[model samples]
Target: MTICRLEVSNPAFTPDNTQFVTVHSSHLNRRHDVSIYNVNAQTENVPIIVLMHGVYGNHWVWMGLGGIHHVYERLRSEHKISEFVLVMPSDGGLRDGSAYLPTKGHGNYEQWIMDDVITAVQKTVENVTINSPLYLSGLSMGGYGALRLGAKYAEQVSGISAHSSITDLLELTEFVDHSLDAYDCRNLHESNIVYWMNKNKNKLPPIRFDCGREDILYSGNIRFVEELKSNGIPHIYETFEGEHSWEYWHTHIVQTFEFFSDIQTHRR
Candidate 1:
């Protein structure tokens, strides 16, 4: 795992505004590059939030839309959370259509995130204390990753927030008419939500999910909620009138932050 402290150059913003130190690693378990957003706050022990980006989205995806600056500034300034840090790494270049899945040639992405990437982040933050709790959230493809990780390790995270998550992979596959032969046996039982949920039935984490009503992925989102209800899984689900655009994603991300923040406070 490679982690560094370097500033990104974005001419659009002022020197200071663009001066963000990024920590990224590329060679952990052959997983996707692990990139994190260090707010440069003045605290040794900060709460850490592992956020992921949607398909084809980079770490900068949430920078402009999700009031990202506000999210960072608010948490840091208000001391609204525990030792706080935001870790956002893309699912490789799989931002657009990869679905955060591991095809035949691809390596084990789920294990990479669950193990290497997470270990790298924890190790990089040298001052992390036992009190530090990890929080996670994501949008679209990222949304799927965030919850999957949390559900996979319910004992580790405080909570999870998902924006426009394609929760029901079985339905999503049919809706998109995509092929999953590379990952599964050409059946939903292998990698879709229908299977993912069953695998995590006894240990699913607290969930918050939302989507735009006009978005084509609305069906998949609603179906996820239905499955949760049928299985008596506790979660928060809602819908807003909009399309599959940055506008909707940006609006919901802030809400996601609020939800995560509240979880920390209540749990503590």
Candidate 2:
């Protein structure tokens, strides 16, 4: 795969992560602007961690704590995490934040992820190939995207880390009784998972999740963990001291990166 970096100048953009870029994908055939950081090229295929944001959020959330560049550079030279590229793409415009869902008469938010976004990563980054495999991780809206896409296309993603993520939309709709606004996209039902599993249940990827005890989204994460456990699914579910804020996500993302690297080693 061939990759190239792009300069982003979108009026709707937000400042979240350390260093950001836009990658144009040729495999899935789509144009995507992705924010990437902490990249290190090696002779073999490098492991990548796709960082996603919640509703009404942009790539800048990763940089909200003001340490993305420092962390990225440190990981590259000291921690050897330089082989991992942090990617944050435009899932969709903020007004249409449907938890990365497909809205009617609006935009195909899921496509923004399922489409050539992966191809764009393959092209823009060196050694990060597509149609091969990847480690998926996300927060909130991104958490939903990571699980949905990972389940739907088990052939692509090898593992998933969904932090404070809502898995079952049908269950999520129990709380959201409003229209399918950008916010409405946050609720996910269990039926959605079943549908994807039915299509590829024979080969579902591994998943892990965590949520704060005080978070409003805590119940959703717990319920998801319960269901997965009841069905004999092995997943990592724990309660951490945090809320639905970047401070929590920022701290958690680092650990998630290590988890992703371990999975990649297992795959190798």
Candidate 1's C-alpha runs over 4 A off are 1-32, 39-45, 64-67, 75-83, 129-131, 170-178, 184-190, 194-202
Indicate the TM-score of model 2: 0.77
Tens digit of lDDT per residue, candidate 1, span 113-136? 555556656665554545567777
Query: How accurate locally is residue 168 in candidate 1, as Cα lDDT from 0 to 100?
Result: 52
lDDT of 2 by residue, 1-268 (tens): 4333445443346443334566554332334456766434453566666667766667666655535555665655676553566677666553535566666555555656765456666665666775445777777767877877777777777778877786665444533455544332444542265456456667877777788777778887877776766666556777889887777776666667666766766776
Cα RMSD of all models vs. native, in order, equals: 4.5, 5.4
TM-score of each: 0.77, 0.77
Instruction: Tell me which residue pairs clash in candidate 1.
Output: 46-83, 46-84, 47-83, 47-84, 47-85, 55-95, 55-96, 56-95, 56-96
The lDDT, on a scale of 0 to 1, for candidate 2 is: 0.63
Q: What is the lDDT of candidate 1?
A: 0.63
Total backbone clashes of model 2?
19
